[model samples]
Target: MPVFGLHIRILGVALAAFVVVAEVAYADPTPDFFVLLERAKAAPRISAGEAEVAAAEARALQAEVGPNPSLSLEVENFGGKGLYQGTDASETTLSIGQLLELGGKREARIAAASLEAQAVRAQQTRNTSDFAAELAVAYARAEASAELAKLTAEAVGLAEGDAKTTRALVDSGREAELRFVQASAELARVRAELVQARAAEASAFARLTAFAGSKTPFDSIAVSLLSREPRATAVAGGTAPAVAVAQAESRAASAKVTIEERRWIPDITITGGVRSFASTDETAVVAGLSIPLPLFDQNRGGSAAARSEALAASLRLERAQSEADADRRAALAGLAAASQFLSAQLEVERASAEAYRLAQVGYEAGRVPLLELASVRRSLIETRRQTINIRLARVAAEAEAARVTGRLPFGE
Candidate 1:
């Protein structure tokens, strides 16, 4: 073949390959609910919580270490005049001193630090659960938006068909020009609505992908989460993450009080050394002990403050438990109501769909007016929209219940 002909053939082959690849990519299935949840776990906020837990654990380890010993050297009577001057009258001592913690101070400190670490871990758990619940709600919204977009697209198709039929009737002198105008207007309106619904669907998917820490936006989900029956039906009886966090904090505060109560017991420092006398060229062993007297600073105010904080923590823990219980009950009730509403709406949607079919048939047969057909179509669309909303509401309630019960919104 000529050079120009060969170039054209190569370009055509490349274009064909590109088309095939695009088709395969478009046919790829979207990620499922569990995959999205796993992606969410890798979000920055969740990673930050994990880092906090690790930091708390490191601090707990540091608390287990005791105070270090000190080494000191002292020289006296070396720079004075006459009898106290020069090296002949000098005295030197070298010593090692260690502070001995008293009244179980070290033990109390370790306990308090350990309890604080536990509190941090509990808080991290709460953060993860809360984020998961939020992600679940976002997923439901995205799925609902996609469904709405599909429904509106179908409505547009129906409107287009009605417009075409009316145009034909007008041309045949069977329908008035006003009827054709109305049909064209309805088609335009539904097309506009379809455009808006598609935009909303894209926005919802983008938000969902961002929440999941995904760099690539998802075009659609593998399944409709709102359409699936929620699996979280068990009563919320377990200790919620919020309650667990509060309980850990309260225990940590009580441990702090114990540490403060023991603070008044002074630590003892024991020193052992060798003393050298330059005047007689002699060396002697020496030992000493020191303790600080609690004359003014006995930690009385500190103990009182710790007690107050502990009391406050206890109250907070009580409130958290009560609130968790109440929230769980409310979530369960809301889920029940939403499920009932969804069931009733589904029935209405079915009946309305059948009514629209009959209206279309009657209108084509010249037995029904154009206005009546339009009204029936509007009713069907509204019923379908309400059903989608109710399904989303049910999913939200399920997610809330799962959050309060310290469980994943979907099954493991």
Candidate 2:
């Protein structure tokens, strides 16, 4: 080979290797949402944060009441008195004392802390529910988009085959030229629709990735399909979100009331010492009770605040119950409706398949017009797509109901 030709061949080989490596290095562009959900469940980051807050509150509640003991030593208040000659003046005094909380204040404080911990932990569980619901929405959307694309692909194939057949018949002087042109035009229009459908699919996939908080898109995922919409044959109750927050608030409010009641009580302190004034040495003992008198400030405002909060908690619980009932009814209705729709689509699917198969056989046998065959092909594909969509919607509805009511209509 000529020297220049050898260089060109070597460069082509290098380019091919580079292309292969690039393809191999390429990662999925979409995020795997199911994996992310698993991560969220395992880490339960919200729960962890709640746990930390609860721990802090518990520590505060358990903290022993009173000023931590204080210790002091003095020789006339310091080394500045070092010049003193008398023993009494030279002697240093040392004392240690601790303040004490009164009126069972420590126990009340601890109780309040415990309530707060419970509230936070409940909030964490609610967080999990919210995440799960959101994941369901994204999954549903992706399935919808994929179904749309599948339908469009089927339409394009049908249209293209018809156009080619018509063109061949026209060339043989067996079909009108206008028919061929019409078929080709329909094929072009359907192909454009297919492009849009794929774009929609991409958009849905991208959104799923964004919601999942993942670095790489999922390589592939298998989604559960539903033959019918979700229906709760069983009585439905509220999901974890409503239940958790209500319980948390109620516990917290009760805790606050107790803490407020303890507020009126005061703390105390004790100390002992020796004193010398010029002529005689004397030992002195002091005991004191620090009583917080509520004459001017009886904590009425705080106690009232706690009472209001407790009342609010009651209302919240009631509201959650009402919402849950409504959700259950809506979900059950949707499932029943979806089931009927799926049944209807089943007939459409079977009819379309039979029509397409018969048309294909006739077209090849030169026993049918190309336009008829093309129409059947497109109808079959579109029908299948529609059926897929119906099934996907049913699954989505079921998932949504399950998520809302905390139980599947039929069962998880």
Candidate 3:
């Protein structure tokens, strides 16, 4: 065969070997991130938050309804010695009283309740974002752990191969027994590491499954890096759930102040009835109105308390906005740092992998020492581990950014 053909065949064989190794390492397919997040929404915490929002909406709708008219029946001047002693001499009155709200009190109450409902909805949004963030982090952790385990498994394979070669050389008197012992020790160490890596992977998967509210065991997680925009542009300026909730609370508080002030308007109760006089067999229509006078307390304490609450709500809104801005900045910074580090780690991984390959080839030809080959293999493993960790961190930071900016990741 020509040299070029030999090189092509060798490359094809290497590629085929890599595919087989990868397939053997991970026989199970990984689940998508969005699917995991959707499952996470079924978690009990998130469901409880949804229920709270629904209850708040119901209350808000109830606030829009007016008070029901009250019906009363009375027998006036009854049981008196002369005119009301018996049923024949008694006057009976049956009436319905409708309380009419003044000073926009009904509107104010509805407005306050509506704002409160909005705040609850915002709280639900925040809860959803929090759940997404939790799932993202857990998914990343599971993915990283699995990848690390795979790398460790590969390392163990290399160490086993090295040990076999060392044993053969020792048996043939080409190498010392000490070298064989060292190679065997390397294999044992790598096997132990592989076991630990697998345990960590299992623990991470357990956490992901628990967070996702899944009963089935997940074999692996498939993670893809999100295409991020510029930091300043990507950090959305829209109202985050926390900030929206705070703002809605402030508006609701202001509405409550109006409601308290309107409390002094004194609702008028219009009573209309039919009066029956039993003795004369006469019936007459009667109408009356009642209003409470604001003599001692015209809702002065209520109004003052509402005003103070409104001020507190306003301050809380300001704080929420400030914290959201700070969170955005911090998440963006973490993403930038992790991305940069991941870029460097990629270069290191490529270089270390090639160098380890060359060292392995040299060791097979007796040109490189076994110790040198083992060191190169360890370096390659570390590089791969670091790369996985950095990728995990970058993904986590992106998820946090989406959460803080009220941008649901994966269009969720």
Candidate 4:
């Protein structure tokens, strides 16, 4: 018996220590939203966009370089029957040739490539802005889910207390048995809602951690993003990233048109070399110039195609500007409407909370019926849920506004 007691005491100590360690491990502080945003900036998709910009810059540099010189060697009159059969009768020539571009073709190419790089850079900017907005929306959703879980858990606790109180009253012959049954049913319903809310919270956190590219998933955010008020600043359409991208593409297309128009100008290839005649035992310097006549292909079709593309680009730019204006206006309007709705919902939540408290007091005093108290409790829960949804809607509208304005969502 003494040895058995010793073993039991040892096991109890080990279990207590394990429980303490588990609690400490699960007590990690919530993650900061700004830190998560920084991590998201380094995500693979954003890095891919940066790589595209680098590649475009490299292409621009390549366009600035002139064509490489060509070297050639020719041996003549050496493979023939009589004089070409002997090395003494052979003629050898070594030459270096260069193509001299005309009609500012090289300059045109450089301009076009540089503008193309600018367009790529603009597109990258737009992509970064869009991703930031998406991350903000994800963060908001996670925070909202967390809030919903907390609210549901509180409702479950209240429902459990109500059921216990009704059971006690029924046992004492104050409340009827049916009242206790109703309270138990309501408690079960709130418990089920709590389960659903927790599942949604887990899913939202998973999405948030994925967006942040975190190896260890976060369970909660440090700050409540849904609680923050959205900024109501007016954004200009001209300053939007989409409009900037379109403008850059339009300029690049115009540069392409210039390149195609200059394509009809012939380039001159100049060759200079030394010729050796073995029979005469002599060497001479020779130079030649070759020009391609634009007889069959004058690049007229290419020029026409480039012009058409440029026109299309111009139209796209105009469309982008119009869409940006409309989108910004719509986002601002949505934000305003959501703000108004959230304000009203907050008032409703307060009123419902007060009414539930009074109903609980009255039911305990035997002045209020179980059904009336349940109705008030349900109203409070629904009002709180609606408030959460409204807050999320407001955050989404703000994120959209920030995206259209080329600003980071929920960022300074």
Candidate with maximal TM-score: 4
lDDT of each: 0.84, 0.66, 0.80, 0.85
Model 1 — TM-score against the truth?
0.91
User: Which 10 consecutive positions of candidate 2 have the poorest summed lDDT?
Assistant: 219-228
lDDT of 2 by residue, 1-412 (tens): 3435544554555454454334324346333444456654544454466667677566655653445787766566223444454554445556666677777777777777777777776675666665666666666677677777777887877777777777787899887888876776677667666666665666566666556655555422364333333445543554546666787788788888888877877666665555434334554443434455667987888999998999899889888878877776886788678778889999988988998888878876789877687777777777877777777767666766766655423355
| Backbone clashes, each candidate | 0, 4, 0, 0
> Which has the higher lDDT value, candidate number 2 or candidate number 4?
4
Candidate 4 lDDT over 1-412, as tens digits, reads 2434544554555454454334334333346656777777788989999999999999999999999999999998886787568687988999999999999999999999999999999999999889888888888888988899899999988888899989999999998898887787777666666666766777677777778776666777787788887777644333889999999999999999999999999999999999999999999998999999999999999999999999999999999999998998998898889999998988888999999999999999999998998899888988998999899999899889889999876654
lDDT (Cα) of model 1: 0.84
> Whose lDDT is higher: candidate 2's or candidate 3's?
3
Highest-lDDT candidate: 4
Worst 10-residue lDDT window for candidate 3 reads 223-232
- Give the C-alpha miss distance for residue 108 in model 3, angstroms: 0.2
Task: List the lowest-lDDT window of 10 residues for candidate 1.
Answer: 20-29
In angstroms, the error of model 2 at 50 is 5.5
The per-prediction CA RMSD against the true structure, in angstroms, equals 8.5, 8.3, 8.9, 7.6
Among residues 3 or more apart in sequence or in different chains, the pairs in candidate 1 whose N, CA or C atoms overlap within 3 Å are none
